[model samples]
Target: MLSYAGIQNPYALGKYSVEKNAKVMQRYRFIHESLLRIAAGHLPAREDWDIKVALGKHLYEDAEAADRLRARITELRTSSAVLNQEPDAALSLLMDELIHARNDLELMVGIYGVIKPALLDAYRSHTATTQQIVDQPTIRMLRSMILDLEDQLSWGEQMIVSLQQSGIYGDNGDQFKAGIASLLAAAGGIDGQQPKTAVLPHRIRSHEPYRIPLKSVRDPRKMGPVTWARTSVLNPPEDPVQRSLLAKMRVRQEEMTAAELIAAVLFSQKNMPWEFYRDLARHLWDEVRHALFGQAALESEGIDWMSRPQYTSDYDVNAPKIPGAQYAWLAIGIEEGAMKRPGKAGEFEFCRDEAKHPLMTQFQDYDWADEVVHANLGRKWSPDLIGEDISFVREIAKNELDHFWTEVRRAQAQWNEGAS
Candidate 1:
């Protein structure tokens, strides 16, 4: 078992007072909520593959850390509910502004550069001030979470550098940095502000849900329908050109769905357990990686994936505003369908042997593995949201897919009519 030396008597000398423990837990809760909000808000605005994957990973880690903090509070013989105590008015205002960032650059600079650094400083200060032996559990949790925060800090800095090099900020790069600094200062600088008793309105609401604005989505044809018929395990394609086309389509579908999944989970964060959101975020990131693999395979064959038309609308755009469970069930069904007989594995084999495409086969192999994991994740979490009834889940999934295809077909007809 793991051990911490020089900690024989936990509460013997320099024991942490109840008030101090309460304060620390309260601050942790504030940071926890802030991280979730940041993750949710930034996700939809960002379309770059690398940045999307990073944000998903960061959100998962932050959510897990928040849970650990809650657990620590419970260990101190205090109710975890107390951690939801009112946040500082200034900090709350700062978070509100951060969430409303106009673009990815602003969101990245505000959250990673400003808010995250302040949270990191707070964690460090807590670790330093609290008696290590008496508060060893909290200390250990803070230390583990600190590593993730540091990684985020490094990534955020690199992102800023990349933005500067790209000249996207024009001659205003320094101006943006200064603006972020000012915002940080307003929220009481890197150490964080003292908590105020004034409660803010509920930020994560089901009614006023956060949806990805259709206009903000990168592809102009994201809502456009596929012209080709849907491929199935029972009726596989034979022609090499058709197979390549199918592979490219699969990549595009995964990319679009992954983006939708990221937004859906963020919107549904309040309705589900933190652990559920955490797991789903990791799955979302994996789907992103799968999309990247698909893109790479197409690029290897000298195919411009972007030039191709997308076949489906985002799930978030079509699904009802309430109960994110609908999206989850829909995703599970889609993943299961992909992994059925003559599915991704069969596709991989065909690419390798018949199509004689080595790189395509490699991409399919990994994509197959990722899909299996995703299906298992769906199996694990779907029951929690809907129930143990597998048939019900499958039914929901099938209906959603059908509706999606219908919408796609309609959109495609309109596009064709417009072209003619």
Candidate 2:
């Protein structure tokens, strides 16, 4: 529903608050969109090596952008200068924020300067003058970086301005001086060493005191995975065809797993959004490892299994997220291509798999986890970016559904021919 935005952080799957979640989502939107753009022009019409190279380079740039973001994450994570008034706490938190900000500013400038020289070399190294850079690789790279900066404005400058207007700062000196002191002593001394379990630093002045429990501990859905495990056992595929199709998928899993890490390294360094690529690599590893387990289960049935396309590519990791944005949930993957896909929501009725394996179930799981944050991203930042209307989010979901069903039917056709 409209409230699904709060589900953005599957890691914190149970946590919810319209305001806080929206802010987190705002950051995600900028990062996610920038990644998608890198692959827009590069994805070729055919599944060939050239296309793969283009995808890989696109992904590499996206990863570089994430690295750029990581350089600044420490700025947010470091101690807050005004930890709601802990005595001389003002002295450290106040001082730290400015110090951290300055360091970040320097880092930003350094990155820009290094990239700027690279851009210049490209222009000098090229065949045409500056006017003809429309197709130049260097220009495209610079454009990606510039767009990244533009997107950052959603929270970059605006957040700082909002902070200034809040009057946490004092006209004469740090307003938090006393509160900072008591808070620090309450937490521990400046040394970060405290006696046994005495109370140390946990208060900040606010309109209300709130208590919240960690949801991951409370939510059963947060468990390692329910569907695949349950489906394999409880709902075995009824027909030989269906069972055989799934068995093939099990074999493919091994192929995917075998190359997952190497694919990740190739994709990240050359093509993916490097920061996001790391996650893709790990997910690939998980899928690969999971495949072996699935194979073990199949071996029990005396099935000699061999599946999956033995191939490698350099493509953007987050590229899957884009399709999932339009079709199903953004799982780490979409198993079928457009023509090779499965069922529809309305026309198609469910068929028992005996052992359940919906065409793109991993993607479905991904959507369930990712779409929540994506929904939240729209509500959280659309007001600031597009102002008040969330029509775009609807369009996005519609597209994802369209793609999803297309693949499912392809899968179902495979099922129909194969399933008894």
Candidate 3:
């Protein structure tokens, strides 16, 4: 078999399985509204023992047919929530949760994967029967997804040609991939997730992309040229306290950036962890400017600065430890988490000219595309990256995910808690 860097190359099967897992995973999510509504209608508090015993037999029956109905769930509509079988209020919250899940029930059950068909088919069928699926916004979502995936696939296919030219696939692309299948199987040997015809993600586990939580998200602030410029300046200070505050801000930025760089080193590897390289490069760039931005913001303050944005503390357990982690936590889990939470994009000031916030777009982009990559890495290569006996690595990654998110929220609070 032709090898990229030499002896027994792997990752090809990981890539292939990752792609297929992604499509299956996405199909589960696309149809969630229908499921939420159905669950809400059948048993508003299905997790409650009283409700479970008395009314939620459907969840069990539904679980049995996970494979058959999941595809349909990906295409459920709002109207599906209002079906004859459902109560209106429960249905609303179902849409609300589909729109938002602050509770962990959804994450725990891994409902996004196998049982998706039950929800989507129910909603879609309701749409046709009840005439409630005509929202223009929903239609736009459907159309845009179709277009976006087509574009991604086009680019993915083109890149394969470049990959072929890179001296690795010396004309035996198929055979090369076949050999790597063994590597993937070896990797999979350590992977606890079994690729049953249906899919599921590790619930409550940090960095497991499918592990959805019902956490509320923070929105990114809009930075216009004037605002950006104003924040970047540090006016000369008169008092000793003001001068001291200036110094502290500089030190904080350095600390955060240094911590992030150290964590980046933890992910360093060549050839195999391709995305890790991109993450490392992006983080270094963010760190380079982190202190500069803080300095500029600090200097403008006429009064003594209270505190600098911290990147680590018991509080920042979920705060992003690195730039790539920051982007992933914010862009994937939180932003997408908002799609199912209260005040969503708007709550976070995810606005544009009141309409075109880049952060929101980035959130959507990461949620729909990169999340699949994140999850697949866990599912396909858990052994190789962390090792067969190393459950410790998985534990550590989740701890980091928790810290990374916590850090961002603290940063927001620090910024908001400023001058009256």
lDDT on C-alpha atoms for all candidate structures: 0.62, 0.32, 0.32
lDDT of 3 by residue, 335-405 (tens): 33445443233322432233343543343333334333434434333344444433554454555557655
| Best of the two (2, 3) by TM-score | 2
For model 1, how does the per-residue alpha-carbon lDDT over 206-240 read when each residue is reduced to its tens digit?
23434445422443332233333322112236875
lDDT of 3 at 407: 58
What is the Å distance of residue 106 in model 3 from its true position? 52
Q: Which candidate tops TM-score?
A: 1
Off by over 4 Å in 3: 1-367, 378-383, 388-395, 404-414
Clashes of 2: 54
Question: Which regions of candidate 2 deviate over 4 angstroms?
Answer: 1-274, 307-329, 332-398, 418-420
- Which ranking of candidates, highest TM-score first? 1, 2, 3
| Candidate 1 minimal-lDDT segment of 10 residues | 226-235
Q: List the residue pairs that clash in candidate 1.
A: none
- Who wins the lDDT comparison? 1
lDDT per residue, candidate 2, 1-420, as tens digits? 245443222233223233322223223323333333323221221122222232333334444544443443223342322111223332233222211211222212212222223223332332232222222332343455555444443333443343345454333122343343343344333222334244333434322321111110111222122111112222447887566545444533333322222232222233323333444433333443444444554555555433212221112122243222312222211321111224121101222234354533443343234333433433443233322244654455446546655654565465456434
Instruction: Give the root-mean-square deviation of each candidate in angstroms.
Output: 6.1, 23.9, 22.4
Error of 1 at 70 (Å): 2.6
**C-alpha RMSD (angstroms) for model 2:** 23.9
After TM-score superposition, what is the CA distance of residue 308 in candidate 1 from its true location, in Å?
Answer: 5.5
Worst 10 residues of 2 by lDDT: 210-219
